[model samples]
Target: MSDCILEMRGITKEFPGVKALNNVHLRVKAGEIHALCGENGAGKSTLMKVLSGVYPHGTYTGDILYQGNVCRFKNIKQSEEAGIVIIHQELALVPQLSIAENLFLGNEQAQKGVIDWRKTKLETLELMKKVGLAEPADTLVSQIGVGKQQLVEIAKALAKKVRLLILDEPTAALNEDDSENLLNLLLELKKQGITSIMISHKLNEITKIADSITVLRDGQTIETLDVQGGELTENRIIKGMVGRELQNRYPERHAEIGEVIFEVKEWNVHHPLRPDRKVVSDANLSVRKGEIAGIAGLMGSGRTELAMSIFGKSYGKNISGTLIKDGRQLNIRHAGDAIQNGIVYVTEDRKGNGLILMDNIKGNITLSKLNKVASGLVMDERREKHEAERFRRKLNIKTPDIYQTTGNLSGGNQQKVMLSKWIFAEPDILILDEPTRGIDVGAKYEIYGIINQLAEEGKAVIIISSELPELLGMCDRIYTMCEGELTAEFSKEDASQETLMKYMTNRIKKGGEAYADTGANG
Candidate 1:
């Protein structure tokens, strides 16, 4: 009998003009945690899709072996029936549905073609206990937080009698405590003899839990290292993913900050749903020409809400603020008004708010600034193509051509397209919210380089990020926020992780908030 629980050989998947995966191979031992590591668009997810029957049997060229026997899976249901279940990054749970309903969505507790409500709730409660979920089975999935939602997803998998589990970027959006809890649950699962395959960009978690790590780059398998063989390190894994030794995770840059060009003063925003609740309180900040300023905050500190409200009141109600551009005060009413005033906000929710995913790359890139390629209300095809192709090369976006669908592109490339859309709008002040979220280290370095280039061009830049290290590495100045209030400010020379955390957690500290000396600083 073979020692491996699963084996995939010679897997090759192709899309229109794109070979997403080529001759990729993977092996998973029973009751061991396997990790798949790669740069964006390097075929990690594609390979998992093949294994989970998302691509079906005839759509791809591959051989799958489960339990020492060749198996042909026709769909996700077939794979699930054989004890294989995959939990995607963007969860598949229905928000309004109860936990019991979500857990046994397709596979329900039924008798005579009618769902048995009592049996479904009972089994759901048991599954929830196993996954460390405390919510009642009758609780609505939407009423719970994201961290809890993750647990519900695991419980759903457990209900399916999943033997080999696949999780893609499981902790990408989770906070520190929630992430630790999920990792611990995985460890507990491993001890219980449930094999797992996790795809993640977080090397720390992978090193801690993964028994074996497989590295893939550009649709080809590079190497797989056994953790038990020796002590594995993130640096070693990074080399295999990028095929080079990266001395610094962030690109080096020198600051050439000039006079402030954009500023917000006495900014306040109220919760849209809760009229009396203030989400952002008396916020004041500014950004100068050639300066990269950063906002460091924990989740729900109102950083995103502030940025959106200031960018034409797209987020909150009862908005009160003063916007100054080039020392002149202006009233910006909507997104178009903000853009006309030479300001653009690149949303953190890139897929939902940033890009038209169904549109081609060329169309999405040029959508923000169509006036540049228009002649009397008609778009010029040649001009649009030329502009799109220019950004594709300048940003080094990995795509076959500009005509490819934006939705099909990887996270990194999609982010690049979003940046291109705003850059083409010729904005003087650019606000980036989690610009490097969900991308690999190599792609992050590339994005940092682009931000540096933008700064070098004398554009004012504002960055909001969850990672403290990224802010320390890229920003010339950093401001910490806590509970919808600006708590502290630190120059690059004085800022450290320790100091930032102090302010980040002290929401009620006396005299915490600090505004810029001039009316024009972000």
Candidate 2:
């Protein structure tokens, strides 16, 4: 195209034991949002790194043509200087710093070795406004929500005068409104002549904002399509990514509902920091003896908070709940107390809260229930190894041995370890939040199989998912929360994307009342 702004031709990248990228070709027109689509480990990140100069010219074989001339980027700094900025999937803001400070961290507004505080704040406010952030620049990053933090990231990129912005899963953690806002911001940026490259698993989002789409699979470029004139659909994009038509994004599971085993009534959770604020309001939910109940919502809709608060109040303050297991109410005020009562929650944040990353699989699995293998103060190391080995096989965790550190494993394998840890606790009620997020399709299938098996085993499984397909496919019943309230309840037969999203955004009414759901269920 005559409007081509950036191009990579014959790009090849290799690791010692793997070919990360294979002659991948990509072209982007000026002021167009180019979506990079791929499954995890499909060389998308590797290609971006190479383009952004994380891999220097000597390390990768490629020719980058920006604005028609050939160029080689030596480092991230050089790339930024050339008006290319990348915001990583994991946000890069200093939590303790003010928004202004983070926006101009290394590139401070200084004159004669003196920082210009007034000018910095003024510029930060303008930049934040450009990205649709309404907050004051002096606000600390930690004080704001994740969606706002994402805006700050954009503002930082804008501060660098980025013409080509690369976003890796920018809206993965965003709620419906926030995600919409981010997409609208991208559209606005496009109008301002800023070209964007977005890499995401949310195909619907890609369809809405991207002007063109490129598919990368198994370290190779498949095809690129112009998304204008309704040329791109989710099914087509998925076919390109997975290399085959996925009959359904959500794998089907036949449900065999049984008697109710786990029940919560009138549960209430207060904000962890601001005790006066309710995070989860009065809510009532139940999971059957052999059924999967799904809690669906946008980010910050109290889905994860509900799971965490109910799990020994591990996440929220001023928590009060009546947990009824087998028609008997039990007090579960601590993590150990919940575990003893046959309840376990596998957190969404596996790397941070779920696993002892530096430790081996055996150590992490047994760490949850050391009392089972403990003789007095010391655990019987032999028995622990035997138990870990048993689950490693049962769960199909692809580790060389139970002794290998968990951090070295893939995201999917690490998730398996987290599950193994909870399963060892022998819980009757198991809560899984974002269980299959950021994993490959094959891994997602394995995780789904495990969930199905758990349901078959008569565990009361409560699955909280960002992906609607997962909830629709695996859940016997679905509960959708918006803001801080449960707005809709649907039997699996009645649920659809539209209905679920209606509740998820607080658009639907439940029990003749419209309310923002604070996840209070007992």
Candidate 3:
């Protein structure tokens, strides 16, 4: 028998109206990276929560064995005491505190009554060095980037003497370089005999790092794949995730480019807090009727800032832009004006700004277009439900019903509700910023189909994405932005990963000509 560090046998967990996990079995060997994969609502996180004692003892039916000893932990503290630590998808770090403080937050270095600041700082430095973070221990967590913050999280785990670490979507928010560094760090940890269980939606990352993959579908374990034996592909994983073969990752689209419908000329936006700093430079972009346009750039390249500034004056201060719609220049000062003028923006931060998590799906979907379901300033509850039901069906939003809370829905379904909220508002031009940020592959294809349907309906769609492949696959024309400026534009036939990266990194100086590689015609 293999030296299994952890084994969860016949685990079954249930919520009030949902069966999250059903007799799920997972076995992880010592010092190996075990990957757990599933669709958005496929019980991956729930299982991890149960294992880490977030559900506690007697709440779920299961037997958890760690190193051949059956363990029943009552709380997170108990689990941590047993050398099990879970770093959640949403980071749990106090932004106001220093790295040393966050590293020893719950478990502080103290003697009887007071904390030993000197010892805490010294230990934090050691942990930081172990994680390859070169920052000072006194540095505030907010001062560091997302990549550095992730390292701090791991350091915190190490502080607890974690033997089996569970990471939920660790690289979901990281850029390519940061993600690579984090993955390499995980390998180093494995060499030091630390076991890891990773839950991820990024199939490519899983294929590259995972020694063994355990797939789940609808709260049931599908199969455990030994990737070390070879012949494990993303397509095979997708089949196990969705329970069906996905013929293509991106849906087929027939483009019908028409005359220019919307255009932005000499658009400039200053930073919200620091008016002296310009976030978006004098940029020009346009979209035609029935066209799918894409904005491609590295993170912090002013792509999201540009979209928000155009949607309303929602992002920056001292905005100067000429918005042309159907040969008419319109001044949009607020969100209401933008919506009334047939322009809607689907925000990238769906959990933060897009939807009301506390409210039900019916409420969120009808929020943007409440007037449609209102009678003389009074909401028609029946009409609202009818309208919400229509969108739920149209978008294929999976839930028990439209009455389910938006927060409880999976990432893909929550995104669908966000789209429904905007689409119901009846916008001619839709600006989608990172629409499919943290969703599964099966859901991505569904969203692409929705985009295609919108294009077929002659709506102008602009997608801003960090994924180069997504932009290339979905857009008819792609624009590359770098350092707050538009660097290059390419049609579908002309764009590729390499060509887009060239423009994305090749920055143009202030008041300087375009790069020499991209000629006057380009």
Sorting all predicted structures by TM-score, with the top scorer first, yields 3, 1, 2
Per-residue lDDT tens digits for candidate 2, residues 160-231, read 999999998898777677888999999999999999999887788888888899999878999998888666
lDDT of 3 at 296: 91
| Model 1 residue 63 lDDT score | 98
How should the candidates be ordered by lDDT, best one leading?
3, 1, 2
lDDT of 3 by residue, 1-522 (tens): 569999999999998799989999999999999999999999999999999999998999989999889999999999999999999989999999999999999999999979999999899999999999998899999999999999999999999999999999999888888999999999999999999999999989989988999999999999999988989988999999999999888998888888899999889999999999998998888899999999998888899999999988889999997999999999898999999999999999899999999999999999997889999899999999999999999999999899999999999999999999999999999999998998999899999999999999999999999888899899988888998898887888888999889788877532255323433223
Model 3 worst lDDT window (10 residues):
513-522
Tens digit per residue, CA lDDT, model 1, 1-522: 667999999999998888999999999999999999999999999999999999999999989999888888999999999999999999999999998999999999999999999999889989999988888888999999888899999989998999999999999888777899999999999998899999999888899989999999999999999987897889999999999999998888988999989988999999999979999998888788999999998888999999999889999999997999999998999999999999999998889999999999999999987899999899999999999999999999989899999999999999999999999999999999999988898899999999999999999999999888899999998888999998777788778999888888887542533733322233
Error of 3 at 433 (Å): 1.2
Comparing 2 and 3 by TM-score, which wins? 3
